[model samples]
Target: MTYDILIIGGGINGCAIAREASLLGLKVMLVERDDLAGHTSSASTKLIHGGLRYLEYYDFKLVAEALRERERLVKAAPHIIRPMQFVLPHENAVRPWWMVRIGLYLYDFLGGKMSLPRSRGLRKSDTLYAAPLKHGGSGFVYSDAFVDDSRLTVLNAIDAADNGADVAVGVAVESARREGGIWRATLSDWRTVEARAIVNAAGPWVHQMLGSLGVNASSNVRLVKGSHIVVPKLFEGSHSYILQQPDRRIVFAIPYQGDFTEIGTTDVPVDAPEDARIDDDEIAYLCEAVNRHFTTQITTADVTSTWSGVRPLYDDGASEAKAVTRDYVLELDANGPALLSIFGGKITTARHLAEEAMEKLAPSMGFRAHPVSRARVFPGGAIADFDTFHAQVVATWPFLGEARSLRMAHAYGQMLAEMLGGITDEAALGPNLGGGVTEVEARWLHDREWARTADDVLKRRSKVGLHLSAAETAAFEARWNAMFPREPSYA
Candidate 1:
């Protein structure tokens, strides 16, 4: 069966587009070469906020749009997206306090409605007590939101499936061609399938997708590699720190996973987008950035885990990779049949990006642009109040204490009820998979949520891999294989 829309890439952007299109009554099919959110989407800084640094680049429009989306997402998925405070320390060596204060005021006003707290100034004596900076500088606190980026992608895919879209993981688009005024695309999985309109939302490979379609267009993506390191918690509070580097770029040291501190993101140009990896120089750069501001010095030895992703930045002739625009650009070739290629988008703006993409494709899809906002609750985001929802889950599953119940609720949302179907006692939740993760969640992910491999369950669907041992991973892999054999790999 040919689909009205065939989306390539199961990253956040692709999945979000698939969800929106499917909800609009389009027959949609989503294909991903690897695990969903396995690349850039999962490797993000994990903040859903306006890019404050982008303001310096004079990207006020991008920042303003992202701020609106940030508010929408916070309300749409309160369980997963929670408000976070950021402390931007002002050193006399760097910029003045007045400039920083003005920026903060503009940031708060630019976003429109003020669901989050306004920015506030902090005295050096009092602020240093909380942040404990090595430089003992004054600072300002502003609001942003934290997200489980991987889960956000998964939830989008799940919502798309619920809206009657065929969401396929572990599937690759081998080739795409325009034939008979329609896209003739061949997808290879355990088998091959075909489709009509193809969307090239393949993040880093957006250029490659265009090439595969035999379209000659100027290369638009400038691949910039960003890396992150996880360490033990640095400060005592929930507030994160945005430290200014000597080069004028910023680094984030945010609270992660209840017990760890996540710091990162160095912008470096890459010769090969597909070959993006973290090297010693990038790691040293991140460590130096952290050590420069914090009281506790951190080296490579303090890093528990490190990850790298290639940002699909739009080429704008910037001398530095950090200066490249984060705004997405949609390329549509009217001369060729209907092919849409997306470039340079962030997690915070994905929903708005989808809306814009749909607007671009509406004419070709034989439909007019419709106003469909993602401001409403997504699949598991039915609960209006997160605290009340948690109470309900705890009351129902008394065996699962507050902490565990809250974890599952946030991870699964309203789908937590369906995941908990026909299970009451701890034993019914399935075998201890090691870490706090259970077999029930793993099975639900496999059977219902399109999770196919051990990594999909451990690394992407749930972050249990961060806490599990090497031996435990091996054991879980064995069990996963016994239950579901790896299909022939694609792409």
Candidate 2:
């Protein structure tokens, strides 16, 4: 059976596109090379921000679009996305105070002000009194949103499936050819499938997909690898800090996972996309940046976890990789049935990108363009008020501790009801999977959400891997494999 649209990648972009297209009465199939969001999507800095620094690059339109989308995501999925405060310490040398004020003013007005609070000024003394910083300086407090990037991608795929789209994880598209005015595609898993229109949303591997189709890509994407490090909690507040390095690049020290602190993101260009990894130099760079402003001295040993992701940036001939555009570029080849290729996009603007892509494809697909935007809600996002939802969840599972119930409700949203099944107490949650992960959550992932391996459950579906010890991970893997054996183990 040929699908109306076949999306390659299964990252946020592909999943978002599939969800929207499927909801619009299109037969869509999304194929992922590995586990969903195994690469760049899961490796993001995990913030759904408007890219306040993009103001420096004169990307007003991009910033405005992202700002709008950020609020939309927070409202739609209050369980996974929440508003976050960021403190930007002002240094006299970085930029003039008036210029900073002007940028913040534009940022506040750009999104049309809904739930997010507007940016506010702060004196060095007053700011430090509330949330103490290591190196004292005047600061400005602004608002942004944080997201569970891995879970968000998975939820999109789940929602697409619920809407009648065929979502395939652990499946790779080997070739895509245009024949008889339709796309003839071969996917590699245990078998292959064919489709009509092919979407190359393969993120970093997009160029390779174009090459396999014998199509010459006009726009080249520069793969830049960004790395992050996690350490023990450094600050006491829910607010995150944006630190300025001597080199002018900024690093974020954000409160993470209730107890840990997440610091990151060094942009280094790479020759090969798959070669993206955290090197010693990059680790040192991140540590040095954090040490420059933080009160607590963090060393290499303080680094509990490290991760890396490759950004598929549209090359603009910029000397600095960090300066490359975060805005997405859509390329459509109108040779036959059309192939829509996505270049650079952030997690915040994924839904907007999908809407824009669908508008471009509508003409070729012989359908009149409709203003069908997915701005309302995604699956598991039916909660109108978070406080009421939290109260209900806690009330229902009185046996489970408040923290655990809150975590599950926040992580799964209305889907948490389905995951809990008829369980009434903590005992029914099954054996502790270490960290806060329970066996019930693992079963939910395996049975419903396409989680096949222990790593898929621990690393992606839940972050138990980060909090678990080596011995605990080994025990959990043994238990997981014994419960559900795979014919071919995930490599």
State TM-scores per candidate.
0.96, 0.96
Q: Residue by residue across 1-491, what tens digits does model 1's lDDT show?
A: 67888899999999999988887888999999888898999899999999998888889999999999988899888888889988887752366677778888889889898699988887545653345687675677889999999989988888889889998887888877777767777777545445557788999988887888798656588999999988888887788989888888899999887788999898989866676688898888889988888889988898888889999999988889999999989887766467788888999988888888889988876877575755668768877888899989998888877667878888887888888887889988877665666778877888877888888877777777777779998998888887778776766
Residue 416 error, candidate 2, Å: 1.4
Question: Relative to the true structure, how large is the alpha-carbon lDDT of every model?
Answer: 0.84, 0.84
**lDDT, residue 225, candidate 2:** 94
* Model 1 CA lDDT for position 139: 75
- Candidate 2 residue 10 C-alpha distance from true site, Å: 0.7
1-491: candidate 2 lDDT, tens digit per residue: 68889999889999999988887888999988788888899999999989988989999999999998888898888888889888887752377778888988988988887698889887645654245566575768888988899989988898889889998777787776888778887767645556667889999998988988899889999999999999998878788887767777889988888879999899999988787789999989988887767667889999999889999988888899979999999999889888999998989899899889888898888766554554667668889888899999889888767877777787788987788869987888888766666788878888788887889887787776877899999988888887778755222
lDDT, candidate 2, at 230: 94
